[model samples]
Target: MSSATVTTHTDDWVRHLLFDRGFLASMKGESIKVYLTMLTACGGEPDRSVTISLRSIQDATNLSCPTVIDSLNRLEELGLVVPTMRKSGRVKTYYIPGVPPEN
Candidate 1:
């Protein structure tokens, strides 16, 4: 058996941001889903980042691989999320520009 202490603050602003088209908001279906999912995976900080896997995302949102990738790419282009490689060089660390990263 395995357990994880997930410290994500994903839903705090959902209600407020439901119609907020200025805060990295996306009008596209897949893009919105991806953005919401990323928020859900972030730490409780207002603009925190988290480590998300493609497989986990696919399971959580039921989005296809291509769609997920495309959505992430779109988000990146929009400067909403910043992706950096960890020391392991495998998993990526995604940071939201609105929040300062942990030191």
Candidate 2:
């Protein structure tokens, strides 16, 4: 039998969330899922933000609307995700922090 190799790169923000903040041990699985989905959307960059809809998140995570909302709220409470409302006041952009820029 042949085994497939799995390769992955760990970003600073991911490390911060998992190790520094100990979120993997403290946070709910749904919250972690939502946080990761947002990070993937933004390419895990603190400088870049993702403008995504709640429906999209629900679709991606296969989570209910209420569950997704609750997860987002939890992430916000932990200061892991920052959300800003657009001028339209209808759309929100999410920013993931904790990753410092490279020198």
TM of each candidate vs. truth: 0.65, 0.75
Clashing pairs in 2: none
Tens digits of per-residue lDDT for model 1, 39-86? 778743446768878877788889998988888888887766788755
Cα displacement (Å) at residue 83, model 2: 1.2
TM-score of candidate 2 relative to the true fold: 0.75
What's the lDDT for residue 63 in model 1?
Answer: 95
For residues 1-103, what per-residue lDDT tens digits would candidate 2 score against the true structure? Answer: 9999764555655776577657677679999899889888987666567898888899899999899989999988777788876535335788777653332
Candidate 2 minimal-lDDT segment of 10 residues: 94-103
Superposition error at 13 for model 1 (Å): 6.2
